[model samples]
Target chain A: MIRRFIRLLLLAALVAAGFAFWMTRAVPLDEDALAGVEGDVENGQRVFTAAGCASCHAAPDTKGDDKLVLAGGQKFPSNFGTFIAPNISPDPTEGIGDWTAAEFASAVMQGVSPEGQHYYPAFPYGAYTKMKKQDLADLWAYMQTLPASDTASQPHDVGFPFNIRRALGGWKLLFMDDNWVLKNAPSEQVTRGRYLVEALAHCGECHTPRNMLGGMDTSRWLAGAPNPSGKGRIPGIAPGAFKWTEGEITYYLETGFTPDFDSVGGHMVAVVENMAELTEGDRQAIAAYLKSVPEQPSE
Target chain B: MKNIVTATVIAGVLAGSAALAQNDGSAQVKARQGQMRVIALNLGVLGGMAQGKIDYDAEAAQNAADSLAGVAMIHQPTLWIEGTSNADREGTKALPAIWEDNADFMTKWDAFVTAANDMQSAAGTGKDALGPAMGGLGDACKACHEKYQQSDD
Candidate 1:
């Protein structure tokens, strides 16, 4: 009876390992999805600033966070564990130098990293998926302009179940959408705002609520989510909490003040400082777009 | 009775002179002047650090702490004063609330000074004691910010 018990335990361990392996398998990239776009690297740099990419990804020392300029070592803490952001710099040995443009697009739009692995939503690919193909190409081109830094990426310090990358496939199946841009075209301002908010800045990654499985709850777009950094709450910017006029929002973006007369603080302080440096038109577009979003609280 | 009358006259003269000195407007002028007051304090502290006057010198550290306290006390008020005036230049995100909620703002300003003084007192004891004092100062910042500041995100 003791011998039989030991065998049963061994079999269960094998099954669990197999299950873990299966969950992290990389999803296939659709090569044709990002075809046919006239990309401009210069324009992409402007879009990148509008999106606020450098706010989180770039090292504090570097002036900006270039997508291909990954100088890794930023730690993202979540419910499961700490996820170390990887080096996406164009280094042949340690970064994405070998990735094809389609593979890069797939990772950004589909949440699938190179090597067929599904990336955890910690990368904010969910919002990035809404980027237009031309925009993605431009971002990619701009990334290529960055000087390569060969920083070996750190491994994520996740707990047991979450450590399994294969499980992310199921998570993606439930939450991931491969489309790189929103289907409906609203006003040009709204479209521009959506592109900046959803694809570029990935604002919802901090502001939107998450589901039990740890994916973003799409139904409640920008209605404030708990900060992944485990510090203070990342407040919601929906109409309910902040019924800002377009001018007020624009002023805040340009100068970091709310209509109520409070200056932005914490992580957002850096964001506003960066926004302050952007073109006035881009700032206005973001403000107009944010105002156009439907205001609803998180469920 | 004559001695008492003489003493009263002397006291009256002293009181008048004190009032005249207080009304000289120097303090108000210092408070209303540009960002120089805060900038001066910052420079003094930096100079102290550079000269090794702050390393382990109890008296120097105490003086530095006192200077910081004085500046901290007037910091928010100056912001309110300057922010309300034409000095409210562009690139300054000082919210209008600084002037609108003056009472609560002053209270927070007072708390920050108290915390900063405590830090300086601790720092005078030793460099190692500075951390806890800094923590108190940080708490003061957070307390006021949570209520009054907006998220930049």
Candidate 2:
């Protein structure tokens, strides 16, 4: 009777292990999605500007023209651990210079690394997954044009359980969806705005609150989160809480001035710099989307 | 009875000094904000004219620029006393980084002073000139705030 019971226990454990292995497998990008789109370098610059890539990838407090160098040593402290931004410069030895377009797409859109490992959602691939393939191609092209740095990418300072990249596949399965959070687009402008906000700009990555698993709390989209630094909360920009007119929002994006003339502060300074590079129409579209998003109180 | 009275008096003195220390930090924060408000008001005048939301009155623009330059020149470190940052005191957006990185903060202040002086000269020129000068001034204000302030907006 004891021998029979031990055999049954071993069978159950084997089934459980198989399930865990399958669930943690890395899922690569769809090949069909990468077909036929050519990288347009000029358009790629627009995509890069909109995405605000340098905001994190650049060395912290990098100023002036040096912001273009993607050396990437900024440390983002989270409940999980401090995720260090990696060197993405076009240095063959240290950066993504050796990566193929398919590899890049998998990393950016699918959060799968070249070695078929799951990347932490700290990279914001969850939002980027919704981006148009054309924009991804363009952004890839633009990134290639930037100056290379030999700075090696740093490993993230995460500990047990969270440090296991395979575990992130389960998190991605739970939270990563290509669906647009906003369903109805009232107009072409709003639709464009939605694309920029939801996919390209990835405004929700910072503005939206998250659950214990670090998955974005979609119901509270654009409702703000606690500042990762723990100094204060990042304010909500949802319709109910933001209280800024579309015009005011656009102007602020353009000039970084509040209606009362207070200047932009903190990390938003880099964001405004990127926003200012975009066209007035793009800024207007962003403002329109902010106005249309579901209302939520600030965190 | 005498010993009891002595203990009560010492306790009262300690409490009084603690309250005074808290008040001092708050007062410094208030004064620092008052100065910043002055800077913002002048920037508003120039910003409005640059946007053409307010009429481009050369005299008003120049006056605002002059006020900005004047405030920028004032070496008011007393207004930013140690332990008066947002982390230490309530109701102020000033970050402790201001104290932590005082040299960087001072360099930003110097840059603001330079930009303000430039704005003063540019404001007297036509609206076209005023627009570009305001851009420089705005950048200086932005650079400092990005490092030393913890504003939500």
Candidate 3:
């Protein structure tokens, strides 16, 4: 009876081990590495602007020139928990200075760290996964030009089970997709705008609705979301409710005024400020892309 | 005739409440809250004009801007008396930080007054000019919100 009990215990241990192994498995990063892509610093700067990296990674309360310091201590409070942006500056000790372009690509595109750990979706890599390899390379190169700092990133305040990084693999299985939310682009300008909006700018990360587990519900893509911080709804830009013409939309982005004359408010103040810095062509392109996206009527 | 009596009674009640603020903090809290609501209503009118949501009428815009400026100049210290921090969180979004450093919070108040004054000056100049002035006013609101107010909105 003792020998049979010991054998059963061993079998249980083996099963638990297997489950742990399967759950902790990471999505492969070797694929789509930006090794072959040659980065241009000029284009890289544009990529950085489009990505809005400074808004997240820059030191808290920084203004103007100081924003170039990517020390990374901003706290993002959401329904899940508070997620802190890590230092992505060129600091050898504090930031991703030691990382290669391929490693950067893996983190940006696949949401996998160099050590094979999965990043929290708070980093918005789900939308970032749609970024083209060349664009990501340019972005990585541009990031290398920014000033670095030694400030340490705070660990996320996630609750139990959710805190376990391994659990994210299962979440990724359900929600992670690298393809554009919409296909069959009718024009090159629209395609460029799509890349900027869906992948680089990651507008959907804030604008799209989230499911029970906080995954982007692509079925009602860009239909608008309630502010995760619990105030106002983000507003539906879906075709059904969005009455602005392409010119009006572009003007709003550039000047923070709707066709109705409503000035931008809430957290969107920052988004509009960043958009205003982009070129007129880029602004128009973003407007075009927004208009082209398939609209799903929202609540 | 009715307006005169009502105004007198209201003035008397407000004076009584102001005297009792040291003992009953809720009166001051109510006063400050009421002031804020009036400010919001005025801002909404200006916002309507600026957004082109409502057609721009210079007279209405100037009136709204004047009201906002007047409200910003209210004796905030009297309305924000002692014992009305997060301790009395009911029906208020005023954070404890506002009281913790009175001087810094007052700067935000001053900024609001300045922005409102600018808006008042530009309100009658045409809708195009009002946009930037309105933006300045919004920025002042945001500045105060970021530092003193809770992130409810």
Per-residue lDDT of candidate 3, residues B7-43 (tens digit): 9999999999878865767777788777777777777
lDDT of 3 by residue, A1-299 (tens): 99999999999999998987796687656754665789878888888877888888888877677877988888888888888888888988889999888788888877889889999998878878887777787888788888878887778888886898887888888899888887877788888888878887888988888998989988888888887866546777757666688878887787665554434555565666678888988888888888888876746
**What value does the lDDT take at residue A95 in candidate 2?**
85
DockQ of model 3, rounded to 2 decimals: 0.12
What TM-score did chain B of candidate 2 earn?
0.83
Chain B TM-score (each prediction, in order): 0.51, 0.83, 0.81
Q: How large is the interface RMSD of each prediction?
A: 9.6, 1.2, 5.3
Residue pair clashes in candidate 2? none
lDDT of 1 by residue, A84-150 (tens): 7777776777877788889988887777876777787788777777777888889878777776778
Candidate 2: lDDT over CA atoms? 0.88
**Candidate 3 chain A least-lDDT 10 residues:** A258-267
DockQ of 2: 0.68
User: What are the per-candidate TM-scores when only chain A is compared?
Assistant: 0.81, 0.95, 0.90
Candidate number with greatest DockQ: 2
The number of the candidate with the highest TM-score is 2
Residue A131 CA displacement from its true place in model 1, Å: 1.2
